[model samples]
Target: MIENIHFIAVALLIALGIYTLIFKRNLIKIAMGISILASGINLFLISLGYRAQGIAPIFTNAAIAASEVQAKMVLPAPQALTLTSIVISLAVTALMLSFAIIIYQKTGSLDATKSRRLKG
Candidate 1:
């Protein structure tokens, strides 16, 4: 279980985010929850690339012994993907907050329930 702690953390983060999204009634809280969810997903993606006793994928370093080559190599894909996800989530969070600010400005309310413009 110790080896899989990252997975446990990922699940906990995701659950916390979902809980916040569901129970919170403020737009800011919703945006924060979304950001948390994104972070959880990013962590999960990064954890997927973790290798036991693995070396970075740098092959030009002669300092590493040949025997070390037998060890697993951590792929760059997951890191790159996590980076991309972080950027995208940042942009999305900023956009969501901006909209929330605008709504508060126009409607004078931050409550998600009260900010609704449609009624059926």
Candidate 2:
């Protein structure tokens, strides 16, 4: 089913991100993996609120009564949470990249192992 495909894709993203985080030595790659992981979580949250032929939970002047709309409206909580997560992810990504830049400047390499050796 199409719904199952969405979840499968989300799982793939999460798996790939974790693999990258664990295996990649580059700081940038690790940051990208974190970003990808965040995206998967965001997608999963949004998908949880999906409904077939569901209407928006807005107060538009459509040909439907408020009571009827209540039954058909997609859950708004997931959507709001997704938006908040997006903003938080952006901040985290920015902070991570900035730290990567600083690390590269101090250690002259982006490899995680090399950077650790430089710390002592």
Whose lDDT is greatest here?
A: 1
For model 2, the local distance difference test gives 0.91
Q: Please, what is the TM-score per model?
A: 0.91, 0.91
- Model 1 / residue 26 / CA error / Å: 0.2
Which lDDT tens digits does candidate 1 get at residues 3-115? 99999999999999999999999999999999999999999999999888788888886457877765666788999999999999999999999999999999999998987
lDDT of each: 0.92, 0.91
Off by more than 4 A, model 1: 65-70
Predicted candidate 2: what Cα RMSD to the true structure?
A: 1.8
Q: How far is candidate 1 from the true structure (C-alpha RMSD, Å)?
A: 1.6
lDDT of 2 at 119: 59
Q: Which residue pairs collide, candidate 2?
A: none
Query: What is the number of residue pairs that collide in model 2?
Result: 0
